[model samples]
Target: MRTTGGQLFMLVVINAALLAVGAMISGGTYLSPFNLQSMAGQLPEIGFLAIGVMLAMCAGNGGIDLSGIALANLSGVASAIIVGSFLSSTDNETAFSIAFIAVALLTGLIGGTFNGLLISRLNITPILCTLGTQMLFTGIAVVLSDGRAVAVGSPELLSQIGNGLFLGVPISFLIFVSAAGLIAALLKFTPFGLWLMLMGTNPKAATFAGFPKARVLIATYATSGLLAGLAGVIIAARNVNVKWDYGTSYLLIAILIAVMAGVRPEGGYGRVICVVMATIALQLMSSLLNFGGLSNFVRDFAWGALLLTFLAVGRYNLVGLLTPNKSRKLV
Candidate 1:
């Protein structure tokens, strides 16, 4: 397995290479400030979802959150409807925006908590549990919105969060970086982090050691849900509306990001900074595809290929296979 530092270095190299190629191919359009800002603004929603996937993968027991994007869309749709019922964005823009954000976050928390409960309390497989909830969330959102996009009227604060900038950096991107930093800190400095790692590494050992296994699992999924909630807010801000089926391909892309970051599928390991770097690299690649005038279908095909490549590398220890073993002597 590659160390987190190795993963970071590899991602940095990939990003630099992509930038150079994009500049050459696009005659500098790809390197322009406008394009860079556009990529930065667009990546946060997927970045948030990728981080959530990372958390779920780190919890072990075939853990994975398939419901992240679904829950995110549901968060936006539910918050818009709930907030719109009692407040008008036209008459109370600021308050309505604040309430919408608050409700979205709260809904995400509740939805995640429900998932955690099912998995931890009932001992349901994480994959199956989240898959079920994914459909459940999507169905609820569709029913509530009646298959229509719920418009979140342009409120000052919300619009700024989605499209505004601070110190020449996008506010949405800044929020994502801040959240990643906090998650990194939590993982590095807290007992919860230790418990999660240990639990994933050796569930029986962790249980015998008296760690609160169920609690850690619940917390892990809950944090993932919170991140999904935040992503929902960003989505609504960027599109100025929420729908039941927004970002249909995001779940797969998010999973690809997590896997590329070297998060272990069977659990026990993940790194936030690595995930962030991987997200940037993938975003650069996606932008490069756009510069090349490739169709969306081609972009999807490339992403799927990259995902399968990484999965093969991890599954077969392809890196280890290629590296000469110092301990082995040529006979």
Candidate 2:
């Protein structure tokens, strides 16, 4: 019986502990402004993907967006190729950057709509459908880029969006926060949010209540894809290029963040704020690992372990195991 507030509180405590430990171990480097900025700059790509995963999970029926990173890569690659055809990133940096972002988002929307059609119209399983599309998206990206990274050529506006800071916070981080806030408001105040939650909680009841299941499902995944597209824009800006294999471990990390945020895989429960906090926590942990000079392999192992641990905790109600049960004597 973990309430959202309780979970959020727990995350706050954990984040504080991680920060303190990292600072102590890194001899203050971990708490330095430069290090904090670096972490902020890197957070949005995975944060957006985690948000997409949260949305899909909230839609229930084993909902997940496994194709998120693939879609993101595809978005970037497709945008690079399409935008490069007409506008040069170096000469038309402003217009080129804007067009690149627009195209990336559009690509993501189309890919997501395709996924929604497969799951809702064709009655495909979410996991399998997404897995298949993941491969499809990756294949398309590879073909588009010819198995090479497509350079975005240092557009000033894109660079500013990806790497610049406003009021001592990374612009990308601010964008992520703003997007998360909007989604939070959507879940709180909209009929679609209510429908999504109800549908996940009890599909039969939702159907009886005249909920539009197929439409909701399609919308849910479409929104997820859009987020993935945004992630693509951020990725291209940060790395200055797009490739089919970028962020190979991001899918696992995104899933890990959602689960750590207490987003139930069975759906019907999630909070954008919680997901945000979870993203920061993971970022802190990653920064701490970097300070410790741990290898990427070790970090991956830790992520896998944490994912499994959280899944088990969710499945088995591990907290209840530690609480003593009181028995009443029969009169």
Query: TM-score for all predictions?
Result: 0.95, 0.95
For residues 116-233, what per-residue lDDT tens digits would candidate 2 score against the true structure? Answer: 9999999899999999999999999999899999999789999999899999999999999999999999988999999998888777898899998999999989989999999999
Q: Which runs of model 1 end up more than 4 angstroms from their true locations?
A: 316-331
Lowest-scoring 10 consecutive residues by lDDT in candidate 2? Answer: 322-331
Error of 1 at 263 (Å): 0.4
Off by over 4 Å in 2: 316-331
- Model 1 has an lDDT value of 0.91
Tens-digit lDDT string for candidate 1 (27-115): 99999988999999999999999999999899988999999999999999999999999999888989998999999999999988999
Candidate 2 lDDT: 0.91
